[model samples]
Target chain A: MTGPPDDETRDRIDDELPDGEPPEDAPDGATGDPVPVADGGFADESAEPHEPRIAFYGGKWASTVPIVFFIFWAIVQSGVLGIGDTNGLVIGALVGTILGMFLVRGDWKAYADTIFEGMTQRVAATAIVAWLWAGMFAETLQVGGFVGGLIFAADALNVGATTFPAAAFVLCGLLATGIGTGYGATVAFVTLFFPAGVLLGANPVLLFAAILSGAVFGDNLAPVSDTTIVSAVTQDADIGGVVASRFKYAILAAVPAFAAYLIMGSVLSGASLEGAAALRESATAPGLVHLISMGVVIATAVAGRHIVEAVSWGLIVAVAFNLAFGLSSVADILVFTTTSPTPAAALPFVRVGETAGVGGSLYSGAIGFFPLIVLTLLIVAMAQIMIRGGGFEAILEFLLDSVATTVRRAELTMVLGTAAINGMITINTAAEIAIAPYIARLGEKFNINGYRRANILDANTSALGYIFPWAGGVLVGYQVMVGPDGLGEQYGPEMVVNPIEVVPYVFHGWFLVIVFLLAAITGFGREYIPDRISEEVSRA
Target chain B: MSRFEKFLAGWSLRSSTPDYEPGDVIEVMVTGAEGDRAIARIGDSTLRIEGAPGDAADTRIRVAVETWDETAHRGTGTYRETVGESAF
Candidate 1:
């Protein structure tokens, strides 16, 4: 297959086409020019009259109203209310879209059409596809006893209670980096390691923070990670280049983070020594097979294989290992059972006597990301509306003209801008997508390297997403902490870890942001790619 | 380059062609072509020009560098609309 389109081809295509803007003379609410195909070639004749096209409606300030409202509502709903519900976010997006209608000068139909156009855009679809595959892979690994394997390794090491948190941090970071999903790491570590650490008398808050810190490391460095993918693709940097460039920064921050955990782990172990022997005995050998499964993903990704193919291979191997070693049954890996009151019985695939609940690792793993996938698509749709309305351009002009007069200032803007967006938005991937365009546009103006831009964009996006109490990563981790099968039942309700308490302890996440900020100001670990434009086109 | 230089190559942002600046018009030999873009050679460095019409490859072309990223040793150039007869 041919490589990605070259820079001149991309610029030509972008210059000729106005993504959704109406013509100056077009009637109110009327669809503007037909979409222009790349090559400065054919028009998309299939576009219907009522189809919404992106058009500038008013001044920059007016265009920004929708995005401003969305951010405000998000902060109030998720941050203030401390509710991380996907449904609530979806509602906020809908409300913001409706509110944006008044700011447009066109007919109501044109505005409505724009929303539809934004929702089904290719960028949003691409992210959703990756999330589905990642979700499945993560879930499968979990079902195949991946976490159990880590537990076994920890037990075999015979670590003291004081050192357990630090050890757990490193292991969780490695697992997250390999798997490329912080949420998956949070679920696994909180469910398995948190309880184990508690039993060994480790401080609950510190232990939980260490797990989050590991997640931030993985989210920032892992090639398969959603934030990493978004940052690389949006900035037009090769995934391999982005990953390689980020290694120094990730390691620089991790060294201090690991040391902190080690010191805290020793200073904070408060558990009585009586129950440690029983906990160690419960660890098993079969779980260790998953270490091979994680290795498969990392190896394939680093070899420059497509991410989807790499993860698929990892998922298949995990399932095979789980079954062949008798670690879990095939039915346990995937099963469908039916009962009298259940509607599943009517389906042809349902056996009369077979159990029909969605069980096993494979089925739940892929299905687990459905809500997040939908949420990402809707948020992108809202972002598209903001982009077409000139809100993004207005913000870009302000930053470029005022704050980013010098290269150092520009890099700092990229860092702080990405961080600010991710902080207000509970979902990191969505925030990355929203802010990626600004980074690309602004970075290119200063001739910043694609690798540098991707690194800065992703570092802050990953860090802010975990450090804040309202963040999806922290909330997800907290939810699993208090769930029925979580520490609440195992160690009583008093042992439940609150999301707020863990925020201050997420040292890795906080350190990453600081590292990037310092890198921006001091030019540490900063490199610009001379002469070469990014290979991938900016999707935003 | 010394061994220490090689080791730090990937970690540092030193430019291979430090003298090139944005908007400088120059003539370069097209060394390679990919799709609609042309790769032009200048001394030891390479420049990528997008949207150059076909057949511009394997020929000398006068272009203006729109942007130059020194550390990456690459720049985006636009084909000059007019050149003096002796430009080549």
Candidate 2:
């Protein structure tokens, strides 16, 4: 869908979009002519010139209570307290929404309904769906020995510790580009590559940052990414065209970032590490077949297939290869167990056990993201509340009226505005949805083209979401590091990189945001609507 | 355009108010409506389009440029027809 936003992209995105319905030819009472909502309003209809949905008890500013409260809770819990439990964050979000309900002036039913509406918003659904699919696919590949395959390739190439982090950045970027979800990439790399890299003596913090950097690269450039799709749809650009136009900027930032990792990988080394050659003992050449699985995903998505379809194909191929090659069995991929007496208990996947349970790569992979998914939905609902409360309008009006008086100022405002919002919201896609309308309005006022606007919007959203200490991407990787079966359990606690320590080293993210700021200031790659026509709005 | 060309589409810093000669037919999404016409704002320039449909707002349309005032960065165009609808 990100590749072209063809019918599949639009159908998947439009139906679940937060605003609920597309603007139709609603007649004006006097003129009987069609009244247009503000152009390109995707989510958060409050971005349009609309009457406030509800008046908060203490005024419109009180609309921010839920999200702001959650933010402080996230900071105190995750930052000051160093607790990265996702369920704890979900609890914080629930409490914040409850606090918000009390602040509503009118019927609390309206506030509660908004929460339901917010939870069901299309943008959040889009991301949540992608994660579910990607999680399953990645776990299957892992169980099929994809990590051992990577290590085998490294062994064959003689890529030692000095170059492992840089190598990881490239491989992780390519995998993320294929899968089209950086969160999936983060989970995969951390689960497999992180420990491998540490064994090869790469610095833990730098290796972790390099993994996140690669994710930023792919999320910004892959046509299948949710951030990429949202950007294109909101800015009136085709997905394929947006991918092509943004490549130059992504590469510009990636070039220097790759070199930094290369140089730093040599300067900093992981303490208490074994010889690099020892990793080969854990890898077998037979495991390399999963490369074909990863390639199937990339090739299918590149061929204009929907990400869901592409990943499904990859999952099937990985499962098949695992069985054919004896890399994993049916029980490893998926298994069901129950204590109840049943004739099905003798089946390979079914086991008579002490407790009812579903296990294996398929179930575990999808189940791991359950808490994160709830957190994302709650956060998006909070954003919707702010939108309905007139908070988004208040911010946009202030920026549009005063700060965006000139073309240069307007561009700067767009860049800063995107960074500011993504900085607050950890999930990049949700942040992009909330800010898309503002970018459209500001860019249109100055006649900046859709391609440029989309590139700017997505680059900042994608970059900031990984670099922050409490960002979803970082949390995903950190969770993998400390999980019961993660690096800490396998290689001791010292191998884990605290989320905050990796922030400064995510060079790609910082450079990406900086590149947009520079582009805005210098008018580099700036396009007017008349410069060139985007291929078509309804791409096939 | 070919796929390769899409990658190299915007490599330069374009002028804020680009000059367009009369007789050039360009495609642009109708940003808004004013009076009886659709308005397309391109950077610092604005083109007033006549014969745009009543529901022309936010639609893709082809327009034949008729008059250009470089000093004011304004122009007038005759709307050809509706070309496409928004993807969303």
Candidate 3:
């Protein structure tokens, strides 16, 4: 009797039906049939789940692709099968592209379009602008004899040779901060200050290490830096906010490094102070006018002007100082800074000096940026193709679904990821771009603030780029140590510090990595997440 | 125009446009698409644009957009023009 519909149930069913035909109001699976989902899942009734897209070369290629080339390049360059200089980046790109062709599902034409879009668009524009201005400023300062001036300033202070490393680090930090580039600062220090330190009988390896440390400090902090820009923009934080948020961490690492350098200077070397006569003769008081140029740039930056505008103002000030102080002629400044210079005719700018003038300084600075800009564009294009073709998406999805879950782990992973990439690439700027997206997305998943993310990305990238053996900074330092006029060749190999030997001496780099790790573990800098204001206003 | 020229022009937004001399402070209906509408203040010399969405309309404005904290979120969408510069 209960098997049949009860009177209450029958009444409820009838009440639920519309006043029209019952057939029109029947359930989806009525009429002695059941509806089937398209993909056999409850949600798949209307659409399919989003599957992970694959690239032409899976991420396995990022590992093996570089190794194959490493083997080949090692054989060719070092005449050994297993041993070679780290030339893995070129190989990685080539092998990755080839592998991509096999696994990527997108049309070949889309891949081509993606490459062009990546190469010529965002990265290229940013690179060109940054390198051009940075080059100009650096060259101008050099031509203006800023480095020589710095030496003069140091010498007059009666500082002993033993204390030079500590002093150099502070000065180098300031230079990098002023110029807004760590790599540029490193190059400048190597060319000018490195030789001077060797002459002063300072430990050459220690000296080079100091220079690199200083560079890292600046790159970590400078508002105008590429890494800084990348960090802020990717994390959606204002520049000032990012800098402020990271200030405590940077200082935490920096103070210890400074102290270590001072102590090491005391223990490893003794002061052979230069006499006043020697100091006065060697030192050239950097004309007050030259410092004016730097002042203009700093003032403008602090005043919250746009970067381009600030740089332009700095350029103008530098040019004025060059002419006003009779530092260099206009023609010299122009010819030196000119791109695509032809040797057919002499430029009028060359007439003012036996060497080059302020113009040449500007020109050299601008030209130096060319290769970096090209590299940035090419790398960006390659990355874009990988992304648009589903390579990036695949990697990102895997990271999200399987790898990144907790905030602490995600932050640690980001720091380590940047360091790992930078070690291989040896180019901090390029490395930052390749890994920035993943870091940002990971932070967002955990509701991390833009400033914290930017801080971690830059600090780690800056540290790793100089510590690795294959890094450009290390190579240059090593070359200087071994060159004919270099410290090793002049005095002895004992006097010159090879980069391989100096790695152990690079205490700051090692310390920073450890500090960052500890910071991550303790979650000290992690509280700045979900920043309520823009980077500009956060600090203010 | 040449293809290259057109391409360059597209990227170089600050250049090519006629210089505007300041008269009365004017409000221009920021033109784009829906969900991204903004009103820009046109001063004598500068065209201040927003990096993000916000309430302030002086020169800079911040807009709220969904972006991952780790990656760059490029906001590309349509914004209808809400106002135009009124010529006195």
Candidate 4:
């Protein structure tokens, strides 16, 4: 398949060849290959390359345009714009789009086409499939009582209250990785883990912090995650390469973050689960069948399966387990698929309804990723138009000439550029999708290993999103903290840890930033080699 | 070595091409254990050694390799290398 033209090819086409000595294999002559049109002759028909006129749009000033709208919406939705909570992002985006129409001086036709192109590319398709499967698997498992089972198991372990935060963090991290969405992870933890932590008398702030940190860890590291998919695809790297490359950095920040939560929990709570013994005695250990469903999802993801296939298989396995074990009837599973009071109903697990047989819970996990799917396609279409219109040419040319001259600076630029984009968007997955094309093109220019580029992009996007107060991860975690008997009630607004409150507490995010910086200066973990592809024998 | 093996052995494993020259002072935004900070310096590749997980940092820190291996972790924080001058 034809991919982006490489540097050597593009340069040769620019006609900067010295004298009459065009290099061998150059596209300069003869009957073997199509020749370029001479300076004075022939219609310039190199496939009518749809090279749109060069012009700048107000929308091209992404940082300025997107950021203002995001901030305005954030303030509004966050109650800074008004006293009531209402979705503000849609209004913000609408304003941005309208502003683009007025401020951008480019061809209106090109802009209109760009909308279609941006929203229906391969990048968007991949994201849609990945999210859908992830949603289905996570929802199915939730229905099966996977999360409740996790709590029961944790309770059974008789952990000290001080350490419960750490344990809970680990579990949530696993859940996010398995499910593939930091936002979903946040939601799961708030509904399932948060209430449980409060009942056990754990330090509410620490508990909330633990959940946020865990979600970030999984979002940064998971192979199926939107950020991971975007970072890899944009960099022209494979998913495995990205996941593997970033593993070191994620773990580097994660381990300490986990320990810090544990330490904080210990210091703040100064005790074990208040009713651990009694809860363990009374809490029926949900059937191990539920655990099997969760295991199927995590194991398949780690096994290097494509996320959709892995999650699909996981759903089937979960359903089978539910019915086979008599844990849930078919009808019960179906009812659980839409909306369940219990978070596990969101997972693949089936539970007995008030009266029904087995069925899958929100079993259409793939459908849940529809928003991201649409967002990705739209972003890609927009990116293509930008590319077609030379929106990227000026910036790319400058970056290629300047940063490309220095290896360390280039690496640093990539990390920071990705981080800045995500910081503005406040959504890791969507940010990854929008900025992927540039990131990939930049890496190829410098011969940066796809894996390294992908890793840096994903790590930075993950880190920056959580550190920003307007981020979904932060917002959802904040919501969980304000509920009755939550962090807000325990510590008041002073200790309640809003998005702003938790930004400073995001130690993992800070650690990641430091690691990348040191790597650039010292060139310690840099990988200069590309993975080799095997040659296949020509078919007869 | 076989042709493929030899080629693989000689290949540069570093992610980016070695484009920076010695003594070229450059500014970089460093992020990791210490958080986001910028540093500038004239690079001296000879003295900039790659760091191990438990290794003590004398002046420079190691960057992560492109390959994702569990051993690449240097504590619970990322380590980076840069010339020690502040950019901002």
Candidate 5:
């Protein structure tokens, strides 16, 4: 007869167990003490080691005030004021953090430490690291003339005005999915495809919407996507499983979206093709070689390689392709030259040179995400404070007890809850991290599959993030449209598609949300992994 | 399961019936207590396990199916072994 194991015995047992799979006899769940699974460890954000009491606020409500304030401020700043600046969001978040300090009931030191801990949490850092790698890889692809290659392909295909939008939709979706960043795809398509589409006499609004719809599709399915990563990591699901399980839903929505784009493209074709020849003349065949680079990333990721390894391979291939094909100069791919004796120039990499600033697409691409990375860290910190303060618990309790009683209702809550949070939050990835724990908890209550939970979470997040005018994805795309480097020079300010104008035309995003809602109600695409735990899926 | 059956299965909630059969392998977590019989949750339905190793409460383990009753929405299984901690 084996007695209850001692601490030493337990330690030995723990060491013998597989990396992510805990021993079969370990105490877990509602009855026994919850054992943390390494792969998709259920780090109950609201149940951290910190003392729950706040210094001055009344219970959990006061502790939750900061999160509520931030949400309200976000809505007012981005949604109402239409100032979709990351700097402004940073300010709002900073102010909210300060206010949270005031509400804490404990020693100021402890509160400060909590804030620091939240800022540097592994979950937040993991996403940021992935973003940096993704940004660099995406920028590398862009520098390798991936967009030019796409244009070349479109031109070679000789797609008519009636078919261009639908074709563009497919191409952009493929590009975004390969690159794992919808925002990058949006900017690329809006800059390259938009002008070409207009030259071919396609309706600009429909074209713009089609581009955004493609972005939505990619964000929903891309294995390297930030939202996909957050949804998977937060729900303790594997990226591979999340990507696979979501295929059905993505395809279901995409078929309709593709048809809609084709139908709209035919009906809305009005351009006279006055400058189509010139646009076609500028497109080079060599640019299309980057498609192979995109293919490498997709194949590597599907083969279960680490995301970093996969993207790194893609980046290397893209850079090599650029150099070998003479698509872009080495200097243009990565320039360190800077003009004027500024503080930045003092740095070893940025000595005085003829160029006023960095000229390389790779340099700009990686640095472009710096503001968002900082924003993500701050938001996660704020989330940590809210979790430690018991805000998440209160919300989860209400969601599970009052709202999500049945499995179907639970799934619906997961979908709608994620959508609502994403609609309010400008940064979709941030919204995903904030609401992921709730989705995991709610889904787990009914033993919902990790892939299913991640699918539902990411699908709604991707849709809402792009469809809303104030959303970060839409705003970023709009900025590109208005920038001097984009449509402003080619077609003037009049040709720039207003973010709001494109919202109604984002048929795919709206359709995706509806499809998921229906899926939840009718139990479509819902699967359970029988005896398998979420960690297993997460590990895979 | 055939592709058609799998497609139809995705449309209905798993908890609506005791769908497991004999010799099937499943992962389950001990969710609650039911006298001497340990109650484990698989998907949305509960199963009573006889002669569970130790206290089954809260532990996740693989189980081999033995019997099930559709009307009662309950099933029985023999504990194969423990797998890991519950994800929830």
Candidate 6:
């Protein structure tokens, strides 16, 4: 009786409503005509059955008020004031959502239901799952002294390897871009390359920035990237053509960013050669065994396995390596210590310690992202509210009717509009999805080809997601730097880079944004609908 | 276009209003509709399609161009058939 209604009761309930549409949270292709969603907007009513929409006091524009306030709050908190505290962002999102309820014109339940709809969205869930698994893997490697191993190996090999920030940039960029995951690559690189470079006399801030830049490079161009796919599909363009057309932009930014990292790497050698030599003494050969574990993840991700599966494989391999090679004890990787461990002391993961706690790499790794994950969910909920309430549509309509009267103005509108949305919604892919319809509609209006539209949509989304302090990519990377058990306590305070500090140094992110702006103004990469047809089928 | 050509595409400057000749059959999305007419705005060029369904907005349809004025950047077309619907 306390549960959801039974079939018979549900039928009765459905029959009672005038339109027979329930007020359930079906934001994503749910029971009714597909209303706009953060990932995909406005499914054809002729194609799908839709739910009744929740109305606001002032039409669709009213739906965006709460999110608009939240963005203003974020701008004031993170951008204008330079406050990087994520918890503050959480409070901002909460207050913003509360503000939304007052704007609902009809039953408040519809508004409440939309919150649940957004919270349950697959986009938020995907990020949470990947962050959790990646967190554990990162910590386990740290426990195994993977950083020290990298330092010793780089020192012995005498090749640049982890000693050079430029090398780290290239490697991290290749892995992330190739695999289509900037966040995952950032975690892996920060866990491996960040400390290795730090100990080998590279500037810690520069190293972190290089890793973030690498992630931006990959996320913008990766065919398998969610942002890329969303941009392509929403714009009605083939993924292959979109990728091909955007190549020049990616490379244009990358080449200079690469040189910047190289020059900056040498000039900003914050650590002494003597200090690096002294630090390498702490490393041992056994620690290097975890490279196999690292390889497993990079390989699986490149093979296009689900991120969860790839990280799981990496976790398994790392644990096995730690056990077989004696790099770390079982209790160190996963220990369940209780007030009285007598009963479970015999268990492999159970150990008697002075303090009673769940202290292990896996546990701590996942624990680090708790605040960030909460913030991500709340932010995504805000994006969903905007979509359901018509704020997204309002923004697009404004751009189309008010700003984009000419061809040049239209392209500029696309560039600035995408940036504004990505800037507001901290989750890059969610932002891209939410803005895809606008991009498609507006770009189509001007006959701006799909390749240019997709490129514009993704480049801004990818770059902004990593650039901002409150952005998911930046926060996720910062969490790892905070010693998300994957890298360990040995990393300490010196290696940590505040999310704000890395902003200027994320060379590729800035470079990419600059390229799009230039392209828009000069029409460098502009194409028309008559340019050429994309492939027959949608690659995405 | 070939793989190598993709890298070379869009090198030259493109016009604001592109022209499509008469008898050209093109597949385009009907972005909006007014009364009995449907519109497909390509770049700065506008195409008014005839015999399009009332619900043609946001749906892809095939059209045969009837006439085009290059200077005016506008054209008229006859709707052939519905090709697809909006992706979302």
Best by DockQ: 2
With candidate 6 superimposed using the best TM-score fit, by how many Å does residue A181's alpha carbon deviate from the native? 1.9
**Per-prediction TM-score, chain B alone:** 0.64, 0.87, 0.20, 0.20, 0.70, 0.88
Q: What value does DockQ give for candidate 2?
A: 0.37
lDDT of 5 by residue, A1-540 (tens): 001123443343335434534433222242356443221223223332223322335655565666567767766876667555566666877888888888654355555665776777665565556555655665566566665566677667878677888888898899778767777667657656776677666788788888989989998888777788877876667776667667778888899999998888888755444455676667667767876876787688657676678768987898898888887777767767756677865543465777666656566655655766676667666666665565554555555557675667778888888887677555677667767766765666456767788889999999998886656567556555553233554455544665666777788788889888888877777776573344344433
Number of backbone clashes in candidate 6: 12
Interface quality of candidate 3 as DockQ = 0.01
After best superposition, candidate 5 residue A367: deviation in angstroms?
A: 4.1
Tens-digit per-residue lDDT, A268-376, candidate 1: 6554445555755675767778778767876876566665777788878988887788777766567666655557545533433444466555665555555555655
Query: What DockQ does each listed candidate score?
Result: 0.09, 0.37, 0.01, 0.04, 0.30, 0.37
Model 3 residue A27 CA deviation (Å) reads 35
Model 4 spans > 4 angstroms off: A1-59, A62-67, A79-86, A121-140, A172-195, A202-212, A215-246, A267-282, A319-332, A336-406, A425-451, A465-502, A527-540, B1-88
Cα displacement (angstroms), candidate 1, residue A385, comes to: 2.3
RMSD of 3: 18.5
- Native interface contact recovery, all models: 0.06, 0.45, 0.00, 0.05, 0.22, 0.35
Task: Give me the runs in candidate 3 sitting further than 4 Å from their true place.
Answer: A1-54, A57-115, A183-199, A203-205, A223-226, A236-241, A263-283, A286-289, A306-312, A326-359, A382-407, A422-437, A444-451, A469-509, A528-540, B1-88
Candidate 1 global lDDT: 0.64
The interface RMSD value for candidate 5 stands at 7.6
Question: In angstroms, how far off is A165's CA in candidate 4?
Answer: 3.6
Per-model TM-score versus the true fold:
0.66, 0.82, 0.59, 0.59, 0.72, 0.82
How closely does chain A match the true chain A in each prediction, as TM-score? 0.71, 0.85, 0.66, 0.65, 0.72, 0.83
Clashes of 2: 5
Residues A1-540, candidate 3, lDDT per residue (tens digit)?
001222453333334433522323122233343332111111111111111122233332332233234324433543323222233334544554455445433334444554566666653575467546755664566556554565675567766567888877887788777667665566556645665564565666677888888888887888777778777776666776676667767777888888878777767752233342454355466443556776676577656675567667877887777777776666546654334345623755533334533435566556544544443454555555544433333444444556444455666677777676566554566667766766654554344456667788888887886775555445434443443233344335454454554566666667777777776656665632212433242322
